[model samples]
Target chain A: MQKNYWRSNLKILSILLSIWFIVSFGFGIIWSDSLDQLQIGGFKLGFWFAQQGSIYFFVILIFIYIYLMNRLDKKYKDKSEEKL
Target chain B: MDTQVLTYIFVGLSFALYIGIAIWSRASSTNEFYIAGKGVHPVANGMATAADWMSAASFISMAGLIAFLGKDGSVYLMGWTGGYVLLALLLAPYLRKFGQYTVPDFIGARYYSNAARLVAVICLIFVSFTYVAGQMRGVGIVFSRFLEVDINLGVIIGMCIVFFYAVLGGMKGITYTQVAQYCVLIFAYLVPAIFISILMTGNPIPQLGFGDTLVNSDVYLLDKLDKVTTELGFNAYTENTKSTIDIFCITAALMFGTAGLPHVIVRFFTVPRVSDARKSAGYALIFIAILYSTAPAVSAFARMNFIDSVQEVQYKEAPSWFKNWENIGLIAWKDKNNDELIQYSSGNALEGVKPDFNNGRGLSGERLVNNNSDLSNSNEVYIDRDIMVLANPEIAQLPGWVVALVAAGALAAALSTAAGLLLVISASISHDLLKKTFMTQITEKQELFYARCSAAVAIFIAGLFGIYPPGFVAQVVAFAFGLAAATIFPALLMGIFYKRLNKEGAIAGMLSGLVITSAYIINYKFINVHLNSADNWFLGISPEGFGFIGMIVNFFVAFSICYFFKKPPKSVDQMVDSIRNP
Candidate 1:
């Protein structure tokens, strides 16, 4: 049961961190110029990701992690208690 | 009232408020002194963290840096904020569950080695001092310019105020005061940004206004900026000039460094629960994001306004801000063509980096600079990038009270960060070094007293750095981040995630990381200054980005050494499991 709980937590972390890497490093830096060919309002799409969008995504990602982790904590706690 | 008197009032009132908060939140015990009795609310801790994280560099100088670097500046925008994601997910909650007063406390206990703890303490002190020096110098700059006092006097005054709060209230005092500071600095930052946004783009929100069309123009603000800057022989304001690999490495270094910063990590320890650490990091990012996002918009606005106000204008017809900043030696104009027109094009206007001011007026009443004019370019102005944010309000002709508010805000930003760094330095000494390692017989009260004494001494040293700042203060600040990224971060990350890693592995990793990163930085930045360009950089990665390489070295050494050694004891494995469960 402890191993399962740890495994699930790692799974959540990997997924979120992947998204984090993609937004800032992938879009913002690697493909920024390609994305720059596109525009969002006045901002070049790549520039927006670099300065603004990635930060917003980071904030959202943390809260989502919080929601997921808190629920996971509750679920695991109840399961272990029932076994006890 | 005039700007100066109003500045005095605003600065005086803010100082008084900080002192009042300090007195009210005075820490009596070691627990309070070190981590605010572990009871700070998540939101308040978040606010404090935001203030502590955003230093004079963020509040006063960052927009200027962005204004000049153009799109290359996103490294800071992303690198500084993205680390919180790593912190929240990987480090903060686990560290909180580990339940430590200081970061070295975790290192010592987790690794079960005094040698590991001592190394962590050394890294913490080195990084914090390098960072705190920059903040102190920032205080001196703001005071000299706004309060019209001697820079030394300014540093002394800043020292006393910080000493009062940090010594008496400790982390408990600093946390509440930082919350207030976040309010003051953010308000000061946003007010001018909003005013400029309305003036230039007719949009109230600077973030949206950055993307909006200029007033009475069909051109988008960014498009206009891009066109103007490129026409003046500068890179397009929206384009990147740095190599992609360099940007990638630099951004990664800064991100990992931010997560590893001891002062910021200690903030998560102030919260009551492991979950609060996660939640507080989220709130801190939200608060930080508010300024971080607005900064780019302000950069665009300030750059546009600066060009429009100064370019091609005769020196005598220049805006009052031009002469005002010139009086303080931040902006210099040379009549390169004997036309007396400020032909603000691209490239160096003077032969050297900074202008050497002579004690005489120029042909157009500008301060005479002794540096020979560089004939390589037609640019006739030497404007310091640090002036961009500080001069933005006056450049836009904002109200006097708004200008005064910015002065106070700059002080708050500088002081809050200095206090945070000082507290951690004290904690590492009094908690990690004395009670935990050296003098185990010391009581709680003695530890508290030692904490205050160390804090007082740290403030004095920080003040000295401010008054007689080293010429390499700016470069060394970058080194602090790189060093932290290379040493402290990997040690903590592997300690939790890879339980097999033992003390020998951790120490070997930290030492190797530190040696490589510091050697690269000192070699390029100090010893081999002439060879500090892109061509000399290893793998086209500058010294600023070498921390990423250093971090990789640390991880590799740690893992490889661990394989050849005994596995960490079962008790350590269970400890990691418990932290993971929470």
Candidate 2:
């Protein structure tokens, strides 16, 4: 049961980190020009992603990770208590 | 009140508050000294970490750098903050679970080798000292500008104040003071920005204000800025001219390096539980993001204000702030075309308009023309980038109190980071090297004494570096990220994730990464400075970008060596499991 919890935790981390990479490096830099053709309140979309949007996403991503991990920790605790 | 008097009063009050906090929270034990007794609330620790992480460079220099770099400056905004993501998800929780006092302590214990610990300590000192030099210089700059003190005297005053709190109260004092400093610095940063934003765009929010239309014009603020800058022969405000590969490499390097920085990593150790450390990192980012996102807006506003206000004005009719800054040798203008007007543009057109300090108040109007050598009309004004943030309130015609607040905030930013780095330097020497490695028989009280002594010595050395800084050390601070990313980050990350990463592999990886990164930076930046240009660069990757390459090399060497050689002991594998599980 603990092994399963660890595996899930790793899975969550990998997924979240990949999303971070895609938003910051991928959308912000690599495909920035294409996305920049559009506009958000006068900011070039790609430029906004690089400077403003990506940072906002990073904050949200971390909080989500924190919330999810805390839940996982509680689940592991309850499962261990039942086994004991 | 006079600006000087206002500055003195504000700076004095802040200093008194910091000293009072120091006395109130004096550390009684090594635990308190190293990690604030590990009793700090996650929120308070988050605030302290924000103060500790955002140094003088971030406070005084970042916006100014962005003002010139334009779109290229996004690398700093993204790169500096993105590392917290890596820190929170990959490293912070695991390291906090390990429950170590210092970063080197973790490296030593996890790798089960004192030699590995020693190498980590060497890297820590090198990076921290280089970084603190910049902070001390920042302290001097703020002092010389506001209080009218000599730069050397400013550094000494800064050194003494840092010593009082850092040595007396230790981490406990520094942490609480950092919380206070965070408030002062962030308020100081935002107040002027808000005023300028409202003035420029009729919007209160600086971030939104930058994208909004100008107060009277139909065009967006950025669009207006782009038009004006290009007209003056500068790059468009929203477009970047740097190669994409270079941008990608630099941003990646900075992010990885930020995750690896020891002073920042150690802040997580102050929070109690692994869970708190994770949340604390997020909160820290929220506080940091407040400023990081605001910086670009401030940059754009300042850039537009600077050009519009002074670009083609007569030298004699230049703004009072321009003349005052000229007196301090920060702004210089000459009528290179003998037209008695300042024509600001890009390039070396202003190369010959030297400021004559012989009259003791800088070059006055007639003297400026008499001393001018060239006939070029394109460039006649030279303004230093460091002045952008400090001069913003004056240029915007803000109140005296706001200008004084900027001085206090710049000091707060510099002093807090300097204290944090100085503490890390002392801890590595006293606890990691002396207690753990050399003098293992020392008592707790004796260890505390050694820590204090080492801290004093470190501050003195940092002060000396600040006063008569070697030219190479001036540029070395930029590569602190590169160095930390290459040497320390990889070792710590592999020590946790890969169970088979033995001491030999870790050591080999760290040394190779250190040597390769340092060689690349020094060869181009120092040994053959002319070869540092893009055409001569390795695949056009600048020194700042080489850290990512170095990090990859570190990971490759460690994994390959571990595959061929002995795995870590069963005990070490058990330790990894314990760290991971928690």
Candidate 3:
């Protein structure tokens, strides 16, 4: 159960990070036109996000990850009293 | 407000900010000076790394390179960014876990030999100095243009600013200052790009603007650029004229080389946990992408703006931007009487046009080139693409505040990267060479003092080089990349994965990499300055790409020699395991 919980958490974090990476680096810059076909909020979904939107998301991701990791470290304390 | 006045205000504000941060955050020890005391937050470290990674080349030149080279410029985009992937996956976490202060520290510990560390330090110094030289040149360019000072005075001023922060704040100072710099440089880069995108394609966002069809034109941005440049007697924008094999090798070398850059890798050491190291690389790229993706837009827009501005008039009518930029000496064209002439006659002769006073053209007569060199076509015009970013606001007639922001941005790019490179240079000299190698028992205070001394020395040399550069900024940075590609990268990769590779093999590989790569580069770039076709490079793999060939020689020679020699002893396996395991 604990292994499954940790594994699931890792997967979720990885996906979110991947999205963060793609929005800023990949889609925003590399494949921007493909995403630019769609519009969002007076902005092309791809290019706007690449320039401004993706960076805001990345900043948010880092803070969230840091908070989550702190909780995780506390909740999953080693049975033998190991502490970071 | 005039743009030049705004520029002074912008540059002044940025200087004050960096100096303030440097004063606030000072490093006290070898540990803090080298690696920020291993207490930095991942996000902050990410920002610092972003600032460090995005040099003047990335800030000022990359977009132009892309606009000019098209798909071929993908080598730079991929070669640079791809290194981070290698860093995140293959290098960063392991190096962080290993807990080394510098690259040479790892080399020394892993090999259990001073000789190996010495070799690593030599490579680190040579590579870093070349890189720093480029950054210094970038700083001088930014200063001279914005402040209207002599280039040497500009370099000296830049050296002073870098010294105040790097020497006083050390890594701690640089980290906080770079966060501020990231904000300035990124804003400077993105705002102009946004305007140009809006102007060209009616799309406010550049990344999408690039792909969307040109405003009222059916062609895509890339396709338009391709067509336009081809029409203008230039190579097709997207064709891969380089040999496929050379492309693959050179790109791979750059990837590995970037991954092994000690300055960039050292930034990861600041974050607390191994996991932060991984996340920081991702965030760094995200921050960098803001500029990187936008760069192509800037390049394309500027190129389109430039060609549009200059074509159709004749020798006397080139736009105001031409002469304005020529005043800065970045764009030089020889006129008659063998004098370097700035032309405004042709592009200015358009029926309904008024030029800005900032253009600096004389009122009546158009500036035309004399056929003094006796060439048939006296009307040829050439502009270096580096002027694109600096001249963007002027070309587009954007507000002066926007123009000022750009001056701050360019300096931020050069200074941040120079500080990062200085830390690496200092570490290699003070910690790696003096403290560890010769004077292990030296006081911590003395070591810190020496590190600061080294910073002052490196910055002085780098400033001098920047003022009177041995080569152009981008070209010199390429030499740094080539050195990294040849020496440290192959050694680091082999040391991790190939346990059987012994110290002797690594040293031999490094020496051969340096000797062979340096020889090839010198032969082509400098030694053959006499323009000897006989001394021309092999298979047209220019000096920049020759590092890739040198790497192959290093690897082949190391492996072959190792094949003949004894395997790494049992202790080597234990050392490799230490780096691999938590």
Candidate 4:
């Protein structure tokens, strides 16, 4: 059961980090020029991602991780309690 | 009250509050000193960490950097905050679970080697001092302007304030003081930004203000800036001037370096549980993002305000802020063409205009003196980048207290980070080097004594580094981040995940990464700086980006050496397993 929990934790981390990578590095810096052709409010899409979007995503990613991990911790605790 | 008097009042009050907190939370025991007795609330720790993490650079220099760099400045934006994601997801909880007082403590026990601990200490000290020197200098700059004091005297005053709280309170003192600093610095930063945003874009929120149309025009803020800067022969405000590869590497280095910085990582240790460590990191970033997101807007607003106020205006008719900054040797204007009007365009230096600094025949102590004695043609105005944030309120004509608040905020940012770094340096000396290795039999009282004494000595040296700074230290400071990314981050990350990794591999990995990254940076940035252009770069990689490559080298060397070594002993494997668990 502990092994399963660790596996699931890694899975969640990988998924979130991939999004993190794609937003800041991939869209923000690498493909920024292509996206700059498109505008959002006053900012180019790619420019906004670089300056603003990536940071928002990072904040959201952390909260989501907190929520998921708290659940995982509770689940693991209940399983061990039952075994005891 | 006048601005200077208001500044004195605000700064004086903040210092009193910090010293009071230091006394209130004074650490009496080793436990309290090192990790705040492991009782800090997660939210409070988060705020303190935010204060500790946002240094003088973030408070005073970053908006100016972004204002000038435009798209290129995104390197700092993404690089600095992105590391928190890595910290939260990868390292913080695991390190908290390990239950150690310092980064070296984790390294020493994880690999079970004194040598590994020693290497970690050296890296921590080197990175911490390089960073602290910059902060000391920042404090000096802010002091010189607000207090009308000499730069060196400003540094000395800043040093005394940091020493008071750091030696008395240790981690407990520094933590609570940092929380107070977080409030001061954030308030000082946001108030001006909100005011400027409303003035420029009719939007109170700086983030939205960046996107909204100008208050009196339909043109967007950024688009307008792009037009003005390009017309001045500067790169368009939002266009990328660097190669994508360079940006990628720089951003990567900063992210990894931010995650790997020892002082920041230590904040997670002050929290109660592994889960709280994760939560604390999230909260820390929220506090950080408040400033980070607001910075770009601040940059855009300041840039537009600057050009509108100065460009093409007669030097004689320039605003009082311009003349006031000029008196401080931060702003300069000469009618190089004898036209009496200031021209500020990139590459507009007059063909025969000579820069005259030693002659003392110009405003602000330096000027482009026209050789013909007729100011026929020369780029007549010089503006220091540091003045953008400092002069923002003045340029916008805000009230005196707001100007004073910015001064207090700059000091708060510098002092909090300096205190945190001083504690880390002291701990490395007393705890990591002395108590752990050489004098294991030392009494607890003696250990605390060593911590306090070492912190004083560290501050003294750090002050010297600030006052008589080496010519190359400012340039070399950037490499500190790369060095941390290369040496520390990989070791800590791999130590947690790879059970087969032995001490031999860890030490070898760290040494190789440090040497190679430092050599690459020195060779290009300092040793042969003339040959440092993109064409001469290795794979077009600037020294700033070398950390990313250095990290890859560390992983390869570590894993390859691990393959040849005997599998870790059962005990070492169990240590890894335990860290991986709760």
Candidate 5:
């Protein structure tokens, strides 16, 4: 049961980190040159991510995590209480 | 008709209003002092929070900072605003639920240790002081600019005003004053932007003014700004010339830092209910977005105006505003050649408000060139960027009443935040330092007395910082955000959600994070300053981003220690369950 939580936490962490990396580090920094080639309403894709897009993502990520954490807390809560 | 008399009248009137409010709503009990009696309306709390969070830096320097750094300055806009998200979703609600008087109180209880609270207090003081120093400087700057007073004298005058209201009502005083400030500053901020926007884009709303195509021009506002600046050997205003890593890290750090700031978090605690706290966060951001969104437009408009009006002009034939700003000492023009076509002034461009020109010739009959002039040349044109916002009205030739209102608004921004910061300092000394650590059984009256003294001391120290600011107002503020990011942010997040994380691990994590993060910033800012326009910052990660590194280290160190240490008290899981259940 402990191992299951550990596994789930790792999975969530990996998914979160990947999103963070892709938006900020990948599109914003690493793949910036390629992104600059593409424009969003006259703003380069890379530049947009750097300035505005990632902030929006950050807001989304926190909400997702908050919602997920609340659910996780519920799932891992005392089964004895439910049975009673 | 003197500007000084007008300034004194408006400032004095505003001061009278704040003092009167303090007398009416002065905190009668500790709870009232610390959390505005936990009865603030959501929108009211939000307005106060906006005022508290948007300090002198936001009021005076943010747009100018953005104007100069071009696209790279998004780090501040994104970082500061992004922190609100972190605050809303992660930190604010839980902290409010935690039901603590101060951040250190939460840390102390969660860790079940006084040592942890002490560390938290230390970091809070360090961070808040760094921030307060910037506010002090901003106060001095505004005073010197508008009232034609010396910087030191201006700071002292500011100190007395802050001491007046902040000394009375604590959080209650600040909250009410901040609401009033929000009105004045926002009006001051927007009225000019609206005028400028309408002039440039035929759009009255500053937010829309930014992206709209320029009037009688083919290009968007930002694009035009980009072209003009780039042509004048400045970075293209809309271009992302910073490394992605820096932007990411800095923005992340600021987000967490905002969430961690005890003063800002404490604002949410003023509301009565959990639902109120959550609702307040949304409303606070909405109020802030009014200024935040409008700011970028103002910055763009200002930059476009700056370049359009002043680029490639002969010394003699420079525009009237240039000579005006030069007389105050913001911009200088000089030719090495003994040509009569040059103008040069320095120290402060806006000092005298009108360049006398002394008949358009240097005393030596040689033109000053490239901003070099004598030390005594108080007449030299040296405009501080912080002046950009306050001076925006006059620079764009707005009405005198609008300019007067802007002055009032500038004071509102500075004073509201000052009151908030002073409240925190008072609480730390009164509640944490005196009541908890020293005199454990002190009476309420004695505690209040000590609190007042500590506030006086803190104001004095803050006054000193204002008189002689160590750095630009915004950079000093970053230290506050950085310290909070490093210390409280990680611990609070872990404590609320991770039941297994114990006191020992939290202390270690917070201390290590504080030490490491501050060391990085200190090393960069003071010990080893190198780079062009701070462009050589790591991963292009400026000092603003350094705290994110510290936060990660804190989390890892904390988790690692947790793995080795015992689990938190059995009660922690139950508490977490209760919070999550709701």
Candidate 6:
């Protein structure tokens, strides 16, 4: 049961971290010029990600992680109590 | 009221607030001194962390840096903030669960070796000192400029204010004071940004104003900026001049380095639960994002306004800010073509990094600098990038009080970070070096006494660095992040996630990372600066980005060594499991 809980935590972390990379490194840096061809309002999509979008996404990602981990902690706590 | 009087009032009130908070929250125990009794609320801790992390560089210089570097400056924006994500996910929660007074304490216990702890302490001291020196210099600059005091006197005054709170209240005092500082600095940063955004683009929100069209016109701010910059022989403001690989590596290095910063990580230990650590990181980023997102906008506005104000304007007709900054030796104008008009183009206007002023005024009453004018370009002006934020309010003709608020805010930013760094240095010395390593019989009261004494000593040394700042101060600030990324981050990350990493592997990894990163930075940045070009950099990665390569090497060396060594003992494995659980 503990192994399952740890596995779940790892899974959540990988998913969130991948999204973080895609926004900041992928859209912002690696493919920034390519994405610059597309504009959102006055900002090129790539520049927005670099200057503004990625920071906002980072905030949201952390909050989501907090919510998910809290739920996971509760789930494991109840299961261990039942076993006891 | 005059700007100086208002500046005095704002600065005086803020100092009074910090000292008052210090006296009220004086730490009685070592726990409170080191980690605020482990009782700070998540949101308040988050605010303190934000203030501690921002520093004077973030508050005053980052926007100016971005203004000059153009799109290439994204490395700092993404690198600094992205590390918080890594910290929240990989390091902070685990470290808080480990529950130690200092980072070295965790290193010692986890590796079961005093040698590992000592190495960690050395790295922490090196990184913290390199960083704190910059903060002290920032305080001196703000005070010398606004309060009209000598720069050395400014450093001394800053030391006393920090010494009062840091030596007495310790972390408990610092945490609350930083919470107040975050409020002051963020407000100071935003007010000017908003005013400039409205003046330039008819948009009050600077973030959106950056993208919006200019007032009474259809041209987007960035589009106009790009056109103007390229026309002046500069790189397009929206385009990257740096190589893509260099940008990628630098950003990665900074991200990992920020996650590894000891002062920032220690803030998580002030919170109550593992969950609060994660939540506090989120809140801290939210607070940080308020300034980070607005910074690019300020950069764009400052660049546009600067160009519009000075380019091709006759020196006799130049604005007061031009001559004011000139008298302070930050900006200079030379009649290069004998035209007497400021032909602000690209390339160096003067022969060196800064202008060496002569004794007399120029033909147009501008400060006469002795540096030979570069004939390569028609540029007649030499403007320091550090002045972009400091001179922004005057350039835009903001109210006197707004200018005063910025001075107070810059001091808050510098002092908060300096106090945080001093606390980390003192704690590592008192707790890790003395109590744990040598004087193991010391009582808690004695440990607390040592902590205060060490903090006072650290502040004095930091003040000296500010007064007699080394020529390499700016270059070495980046080295702090590189060393931290290469050494501390890998050690702590591996200690938590890779349970098989033994003392031999961790120590070997840290030492290798430290040696390689330092050698590369010193070779290129300090010792052989003339050859510090793209052609000579390994893998085309500059010294600023070599830490990423060092980190990779650290991981590889540790894993290989761990394969040969026996696994960590059973009890250590159980301890790792416990931390992983909650």
- Compute each candidate's TM-score over C-alphas: 0.99, 0.97, 0.83, 0.96, 0.85, 0.99
Which pairs clash in model 3?
B316-B345, B316-B346, B317-B345, B317-B346, B317-B347, B317-B348, B318-B346, B318-B347, B336-B370
What tens digits encode model 6's per-residue C-alpha lDDT throughout B485-514? 999999999999899999999999999999
By summed lDDT, the worst window of 10 consecutive residues in model 2 chain B runs over: B360-369
Query: How much lDDT does each candidate structure score?
Result: 0.94, 0.89, 0.74, 0.89, 0.74, 0.93
Q: Point out where model 4 deviates above 4 Å.
A: B348-356, B362-378
TM-score of chain B of 6: 0.99
lDDT of 1 by residue, B1-582 (tens): 999999999999999999999999999999999999999999999999999999999998899999999999999999999999999999999999999799999899888889999999999999999999989888987998889999999999999999999999999999999999999999999999999999999999999999999999989999999999999999999999999999999999999999999999999999999989999999999999999999999999999999999999999999987888888888999899998888998999999858999999977888888899999999988998888998999999999999999999999999999999999999999999999999999999999999999999999999989989988888997799898999999999999999889998999999999999999999999999999999989999999999999999999999888888888888888888888877
Candidate 6 or 3, higher lDDT: 6
Q: Write the per-residue lDDT of candidate 2 for residues B156-176, one digit (tens) a residue.
A: 999999999999988999999
In angstroms, the error of model 3 at B186 is: 0.5
Off by over 4 Å in 6: none
Per residue, candidate 5 scores C-alpha lDDT tens digits across B1-582 of 655577777777887887788778887778777888899999899899999988888888889878767777777766777677667766777778877798888888888888998999998888788788878877776776677778899888888878887878878877898888888788878888899889988888776566678889767777666666666555677676666677678777877888898889889889998767767887787777678767766777777776555444455566554555455555555443434444232233333333233435454332233334444432333345666777677667776667777777787888888878888988988998888887999998888788888888999889877876774555556577777888899998888768788988999999899888888787777677664235666557678788998899899999898788888777776676555443
Which DockQ-derived CAPRI band holds candidate 4?
high
What is the C-alpha lDDT profile of model 3 across A1-84, one tens digit per residue? 345444545565576657655654465445655776776533455545534454455455654654565565455655325543
- Please state every model's RMSD to the true fold in angstroms: 0.8, 1.9, 7.0, 2.3, 5.5, 0.8
Error of 5 at B234 (Å): 2.3
Runs with alpha carbons beyond 4 Å of true place in candidate 2: B350-377
Candidate 4 lDDT by residue in tens digits, B467-504: 88665766876788998999999999998877789988
Candidate 6 C-alpha lDDT tens digits along A1-84: 878988999999999999999999999999999999999888998888988999999999999999999999999999899999
Give the Cα error of residue B366 in candidate 1, in Å: 1.2
Kindly give the number of clashing pairs for every candidate.
Answer: 0, 0, 9, 5, 18, 0
Q: Alpha carbon lDDT of residue B71, candidate 6?
A: 91
